[model samples]
Target: GITLSGGQRQRLAIARALAVDPRILILDDATASVDATTEARIRLGLREAMKGRTTLIIAHRLSTIALADEIVVLDDGRIAARGTHDDLLETSVVYRDIYEHGLLERQFADAVEARGGRQPLEAAS
Candidate 1:
């Protein structure tokens, strides 16, 4: 039996989806399993592949949907806000919270990496 890591499986799934060339693509946290670097590459490829298609991306990571034509922020299964990223950041508390949290996580990860993967004591507490 062959075993694939989560990132590998995600990339495979994305490839399969793109191969079908569907009129619409629904990606739910599609890049969640991959590291930021791999996710960036996938995003670039997806942008090219999705140029003529309608894409519905449900993602908590702001980077995943950064290039979207429209962003619909959902809160508690309801549409809380709808707009571009900047617009939501200004007008939607839900969107701002998500974005800020994600940003902080990335910053923390970066700090850990900068310190050779040593998490700060404060972070561990």
Candidate 2:
């Protein structure tokens, strides 16, 4: 038996879920314990697995939710608004606040433009 850290356990759980290859997958804050880089890598791997499969991701992290083709904003167990990221930004105050508060997903495009299209990795090294 191997002792796993919180992030490692989370990754194992995700792998176990995906290994089943179900048509629909549901996640509830699955990556909360992981660092940004690890989360990004997990998202990259999951992206391929998610194709043509229905995924219900219940996440407060905007970066995770932003990848969805459509977003459903839930308020108090009811649907508050549903739309694309751009659409929700215009029409939903709740969804917009998640970004405005700087808790998740910065205005990455503006930051990238400021750096003249160079990636963060390129800028760092």
Judged by lDDT, which candidate is best? 1
* lDDT per residue (tens digit) for residues 1-125 in model 2: 88989999999999999999999999889889997789899999989989989999988787887879999998889999999888999999988887686552455655666789875557475
- Model 1 sits at a Cα RMSD from the real structure of 2.1
- Candidate 2 local Cα displacement, residue 46, angstroms: 1.1
Candidate 2: pairs in clash: none
Each prediction's number of clashing residue pairs? 0, 0
Q: Residue-wise lDDT of candidate 1 within 1-125, one digit each (tens)?
A: 99999999999999999899999999989999999999999999999988989999989889999778999988899999999989999999999999999999999999888888898555653
Determine the C-alpha RMSD for candidate 2 after optimal superposition of all C-alphas. Answer: 6.7
Provide the clash count, candidate 2: 0
lDDT per model vs. reference: 0.91, 0.85
TM-score (C-alpha, index-matched) for candidate 1 = 0.94
